[model samples]
Target: MDGERLFCDIALAARIERAEARLIAESSGAARARRGDSVGFARPFAGGVASFAEADSPFDKVAGLGFAGVPDAAELDEIERAFAELGAPVQIELCQLADAAVGAFLTGRGYRLESYENVLGRRVGDATFPDGVRYCRDDELETWLAEVADAFAVADTEGLPSHEEFPRGTVIDAMRDMAGVLRFVAERDGDFAGGASFRVTDGIAQFTGAATVPVHRRRGVQTALLRARLAVAAEAGCDIAVVTTQPGSKSQQNVQRQGFDLLYARAILVKGTSAISSSGADSRQAS
Candidate 1:
């Protein structure tokens, strides 16, 4: 409210969650086209999107829920049926600001709380891309993907550890095919040291993910990447920038240092565990 700072309200949650739903849906559509199959599906349910990128890929979950109120019995049934058909779990990232009825319905149907991810935001203002950070060229896409995937594979011991894991190649493909994504790269001594990305929607700059390679850790690579994306987002006229991060993790700490405040947190709930916990339910794949 004051100074144009964002408030953690239903309106803000709806905007961020809906934008994320559309982005994931588009990314899944792109993945399906690439593989020429029905592996990726985005189903609209409860005013949100229930998407499946693959059995184990991270883009598989229901997002943007509760914005339109709690789902009815039939709507819930449809969502369950859709994921069941794909032999995947019904994973939902329920915003804490969502209607209490929504969480009641989910847990009543056997959805267990698996994890939580904090959503941080900041009003867009002045930002400058630090030296050695720039947009990733088309020719350097593969290298950027490799670095990001590798960084994710090396699990950080702090915060909550991911409940699921995917092959490195799967991670790469997910990042590569994410629709409307803008990629950025950070360098150290003229070598690729880290990468980051963002997507703008309705004046909200969504910082999707960022990571530094193992060899370049603690060298301010992620900080540079974050600044570069913020500058780019401001140039694009975004009013706000947001990122999701594992609670208490280094990523969360890093963004906080950059002036991002905790806008809200998403309670990750799941209904099935027959397969690996639907990967990427956290939204922040690397960061």
Candidate 2:
């Protein structure tokens, strides 16, 4: 990764936010219809997308909001109403670089701060593909998904605990909902040890999420997976790769060690009766 084209600016934030919003939309659109599923959907409002993957699903929230501009009272009211109709709180992952007026608007509407997450980025120039890590084959998609879901089910103790704990099936279903993502698998002694994924949109590669199983933690599995993905991202013509991590967590440290910089942070703010623990954060498990 090089510094020439890498920067932390509103222009860069726009690219990242737009990619994330599109991914959420794709996930919501691909939501499966099952007997008891809550019927997920994504609504584009103001400058971003408000999505619901199911009640309490980590995927249920507003992402990339207010990037285009601050919303009017009517837009905010409709966003709240959409979540209210589903009996879920309105959660917004508001970027720090978003229009300042939007933050005041949210505060006036009684949205309280829940947690914060950091977005790290690096130029995708070149990387050596780590041994034992490779792109997930089509036939191994389910196995890769299962491995990642299982790892994420157990929150990393080195970081602030996750605000939510989803069922194993819910995690898998949520992952399945993401469209056009490239998956990777890391093996140790020929056994599945970890999994990771990234989605490229207009040269920005967003590392969706990654996890190493309990037995594989601290074995460099995630690092290998990360390097493998970075290598692939470069080959795919991506100029930058970004990942979100809980502030001060091991995941954040790991990425920083790989030359990623703290690009920006998103304050997780919410309105309604959802119980957000003071000691928990709203970030994907990436260790």
Candidate 3:
């Protein structure tokens, strides 16, 4: 397939995964809204009108204010108004397929291209992982969550929700409700060390929430988890596997080391004068 078409497919699949996460959040009684490709969710739930734990996984965000083929300046104005209504400075991530008109409208209204992420993709193949990686059992979710929370805290301690959210009051409770998504964790000396999540839809699988505790960094914990998830995706008949990471990040290096190719760089655009104001409080990259 062509580059633009492939990127769109990846984007759509990512959005579908995101929408599913939001729907699950709403089903779990969290407040959220969906409009085409755009979804708005409430705070502390992981998926909401105000996202607290932003990741590279497609569904890791809370809302999309402008990247819905919405080339109309008038509608763009309405979107800004909606952002104001929500009372959170939501970001809109878009690929190269986005029309110049959309970019122009967002820019004219004070939107800034603050950062970009690389969306990498590759066809399914053999799934080989290092020893010690294993799937998370239903009964072991709490342990897994705690370990992940610890790992994430090490990555960005301030961005995570208080221990009172869900699945110990973190949004992971809603994630556990998602279909076709599986969790894998690594163990060292029989203690949870690192882990990752896989979300499969329309023959595409995405690796998400990969984390390794501070004590486990650079010790092949994530590499093993990644291969395990890819193998699972391939065994399930997936045609493509995708992962997103910040440009020049160590996580990006990990995926590339696993043979994932550079698909496209998705731009994370922020609107309003408060653009990036939430970075210190909400910015945390995925593994």
Candidate 4:
């Protein structure tokens, strides 16, 4: 990989991650705001509240002390406050694009590494729409969401629902009601077979929630849905298309076949709600 392009892609991907987190936060009725170099978000859901990427300082500021150019130690101190304010645990996702110092800082402050994921990206290219692929219409949102939910209901790696059942609604309704999210469904010989959803911003787009039923696998359904989304993104004036996947998963293999490259690996670091015991922040009710 060209070194410059690798860094640029990593940085651009950090921006996309921030946008995605912000969208999820706002949709869940979480409070979100950019404070200095980082964006903080809190939600009422099971997920934790946290921050991503410090803004614009490569150690030139703060006498070389703050991690990722954050103005001071207050960045994380306030993040802790934000999580409590949301009645959630604190979980910060640090992109590889951030300064190495931040990781060390987080570890020193008691955040434990939770998981790793790859942020992949590629320039959108035109592809002829495969047979049975089409942009999902708004009225068909529930159908599209159902197909996607079924695709992901897997109890195993192959995505087969562990309980011999696929969901029909609920989560689909939530996603459909979210702002700025779009879905695309694929048909196989006239039956709804697979689907994916995406959001675009700042000339970039993230293809998310992609899935295909077990019976529909290996039919090129996913690739078709992918290329279709790329075409739509390009026409919408987006240049970069991005996706996040487990580092060594099947989905990574599929997208890599289409020219996508690993931009960076992000670590999900989490701190427990009980960890705040010493900080005396528990009794305070979330605002």
Taking all chains together, the TM-score of candidate 2 against the true structure is: 0.92
After aligning candidate 3 to the native by TM-score, how far in Å is the CA of 80 from where it should be?
2.7
lDDT of 4 by residue, 1-287 (tens): 21123334445655665565655454433212222323433332212223322211110001111223532466557756765554555555567776777678768888776555667888765545566787789787656666666556541252111111212343444445344767777888888777777778667777765777668777787788778877788778777788866556667777777667788776766676423111111100000
Return the candidate ranking by TM-score, descending: 1, 2, 4, 3
Q: What is the lDDT of residue 20 in candidate 3?
A: 35
lDDT of 1 by residue, 1-287 (tens): 21465677789889989898988888888889888887657888889998888767678888998878889889789878888888888889999898999999889889998888889999888777789988889997888888788887765566766666777788888888788989988889988788888999888999988877778877888788888988998899998899988888888888888888899988989888734443443336344
lDDT, candidates in the order shown: 0.82, 0.80, 0.56, 0.55
Q: Provide the TM-score for each candidate, comma-separated.
A: 0.93, 0.92, 0.70, 0.71
Angstrom error of the Cα, residue 166, model 1: value is 1.6
Please write out the lDDT profile of model 2 over residues 164-270, one tens digit for every residue: 55667777877777778888889898888988888898898889888888788898987888899899888999988899888888888898888789989898898
Off by over 4 Å in 3: 1-70, 156-180, 273-287
Candidate 4 CA-lDDT value? 0.55
Residue 242 of model 4, lDDT score: 81
Which lDDT value does model 2 have at 277? 53
Q: Which ten residues in a row are the worst by lDDT in model 2? A: 276-285
Candidate 2 residues lying further than 4 Å off, grouped into runs, are 1-5, 32-38, 277-283
What is the full ranking by lDDT, best candidate first?
A: 1, 2, 3, 4
Please report the TM-score between candidate 4 and the true structure: 0.71
